[model samples]
Target: MSAKFHWVLMVVFVCGCHAGAASIAESFTSYKLVPNIVTKAPANVISVKFPSGAVVDLGNELSKPQVALTPSVSWNAGDGLYTVIMFDPDAPSPSNPFISSFLHWLVINVQKDGIASGDTIAEYLHPYPPPFGDIHRYVFLVYQQRERLPVKDFIAYSTIGRFKFSPQDFADNFNLGDPVAGNFFRTQFNSLKTDKLF
Candidate 1:
């Protein structure tokens, strides 16, 4: 190949990699998760793939995930105990979020191998944005646990229900520190069907 053509290809390849990383950071900032939900962008990107083969991109809109096993999450983080939580910061409605940061799922002490092996404090609750409300951002955050969370704390959090649940608070209470990886997707009510195979 010509030297000029090779240079062009290299530029494209480099830019593509940068864009992939930037998209994850940009999406978190553009969605205002930086200061509201998390203090800083996670260092790693998380992949959440549902049972029907739908993957959660930065902020892509997806149909309601049907009742099924917790989506499989793949990441490059090293082996260690992890905690995964999913919540909707735009609960009720983005404009009027009387109940903000509604927790959808919480699994603690998850092994590096898989989330299913972890202790499920609270079962996964699928996205259920209000029919007339605007799109909701369902965010999943993964934290590297320093140590096993207290069993008592798990019982307390589980009893609090899903509304007004704060993942940050949970982290702080347990001293999990900031999340190391995260992912989010937007969704709204759709009665047509769920578990889309795309």
Candidate 2:
């Protein structure tokens, strides 16, 4: 083979490798679960562990798993209070989401690398996508807070049926700025009973 031809092949091989890696990373960044309201990328990635010791990935597809309690989360936020949000942006159905971004969980004033405690504003609501509905994206977003803010009213606001909630608006209103870390998982109704909840 000619030296010039070999060089071209090597270049193509390297570019292909890079493209594969980029596509994997883009999967998380391009996730439509996170409303265009908040920044797409975060400063860091947070690790979330289910009760069954399963660590959640960016777009892990889970069946109706038994997520009775809140998943444990850890992040490197240094010495600052942080806010955690878990919501399903594809409520009811993705095509016509009248109740978009249904808030599932909210914890505030969390310390670095810690699980939510008494500071939980809204309680965790396990994912329960309706049968035959589109897969729902359960997003977990973390934000560094400026200070401890009153969230009781905000928690109440989430309970109202068909209430509109925007993570971007919440961050802006509380001056939380961009998210520090985030991750999500996808779930849908399990008619076959193939997967077990953690």
- Top candidate when judged by lDDT against the true structure: 1
Among residues 3 or more apart in sequence or in different chains, the pairs in candidate 2 whose N, CA or C atoms overlap within 3 Å are 65-197, 66-197
What tens digits encode model 2's per-residue C-alpha lDDT throughout 1-198? 999999999999999867754543465558754346465556466788888666777888865664545788887678878888888878777777778878888888887767645387677887888876688887788898888777664667447722466777777888988887877788887766544532
Report clashes for each candidate as comma-separated counts: 0, 2
Please write out the lDDT profile of model 1 over residues 1-198, one tens digit for every residue: 899999999999999878876877888999989888888777668889998688888888877754244688877667778998888899899888888888888888888838887888777877767778788898989999998776566765565667788777877878889888888988887666544531
Worst 10 residues of 2 by lDDT: 32-41
What candidate 1 gets wrong by more than 4 Å, as runs, is: 1-19, 65-69, 191-198
- TM-score, prediction 2: 0.78
Residue 171 of model 1, lDDT score: 78
Per-model TM-score on C-alpha atoms: 0.83, 0.78
